[model samples]
Target: CQELPLIPEQDSRDIEVVCNLYESLLTLQRQGINGIWARIIKNAFAPLFNKEFDYVAGNPPWVNWESLPENYRQDTKPLWQEHGLFPHGGMDTILGKGKKDISMLMTYVAMDKYLKKGGKLGFLITQSVFKTAGAGQGFRRFRLGSGEHIQVQHVDDMVELQPFEGASNRTSVV
Candidate 1:
C-alpha cells in the first residue's frame, strides 16, 4: 500500500482472505507451511489492514532480513526503513548485519493497523528477540503516537525447550 498512513486501509477481499485462511489453513496435527504465502498466493495480495480489532493472531513466516533476496530488501524498504531494521551500516555489519525477521516487522505492522489501543497482542517469534541486541532491541522497544511508549506485560521464557519438531531455531510466544 502506497498509502502514507500509520495503518494501511484494508478492503473487503482482505477480510475474506484472512477469514478463510485462519478458519481452515491450520489443522490439529499442525502441518508445516510448505513453500509459504508467496507460493500459495502467487503474488496476488499484500498485508491486510483494518481500523481495529479486539485481537489479531498469526504465525508469520520466519525469514531474516539478511537472508532475504536483494529484491525483497529493496521492495520493502519504503515501509520498514524508518525503523532501521533492515541491513545497513558498519555497526549493523558486525551484528549479523542487524538482521531482523520479517515476522518481527509484521508484529509492528499488525499491532499498528489492526489492534485496538490497550489490546493484547500475541505472536510466536524467535526467542532471539529477548536474547540478542541491535534489531532485537528495536523489537523490545515500544513507542506509540507522539514518541510515547508502552509497557511489557509478561514474557514466557522458553529457552531450554524445543517447541517444534525438526525446528532448531529457538522460538517463543510473546
Candidate 2:
C-alpha cells in the first residue's frame, strides 16, 4: 500500500507508461539489446518484491519547477494546492517561499498509506523540513499523532557534505 507522489518532469501527458516505454526503448537501443532487456525485466519485476531491512533510506531529488517541464508544472500545481503548499512558476521558485523536499512529503505519504502500524520510517530530509514555516509545520502536525499518524525518530545533519554536491543531489535522504 505504499503510495508515492508522481512528479511529472514535462507535461502530465508525458507522465504515462507509454512515454516511459519509449524512453526505455531509446535507452536500450543505445545500450544494446542485452542491456535493454535486462532493464526491462528488472523494471517489470522490481515492484513485486518487498525488501526487508532495518531502515528505509535515501536522499530525494532536489529539482525545482524551472528544471521541470511545463507539463509537470501543470500536473503538480493541484498537488501543491491540495497540500496547501503554494504553487509558483516552478519548483525552484517555490523554494524561495520555503517549501520542504518532495521526497520528505513522499516518505510521509508512503508511511501513512503503506507501512504497517508500528512499522518505522526514517528518512533524511532537508533543513527546510525542520526550519520552514508552513510545510514544516504541516509535517510536524502530521507526525504528532494527528491525522493518519506517522512518527519521527531522529534528524541529523549530514556530517559529510560531499554526497550532496553531485549530479544526484536529489538522491539525498528526505
Per-model TM values vs. the true structure: 0.65, 0.50
lDDT of 2 by residue, 1-174 (tens): 012245566645535655666677777788765323534755665675445444455544455534555565575555544553442336644556444456544555456444667766666556655666555565555552224544556666663664556633322243
**lDDT (Cα) of model 2:** 0.52
Which candidate has the top score in TM-score? Answer: 1
Q: Give me the candidate number with maximum lDDT.
A: 1
Distance from true position, residue 96, model 1, in Å? 2.4
Model 1, residue 106: C-alpha shift (Å) = 0.9
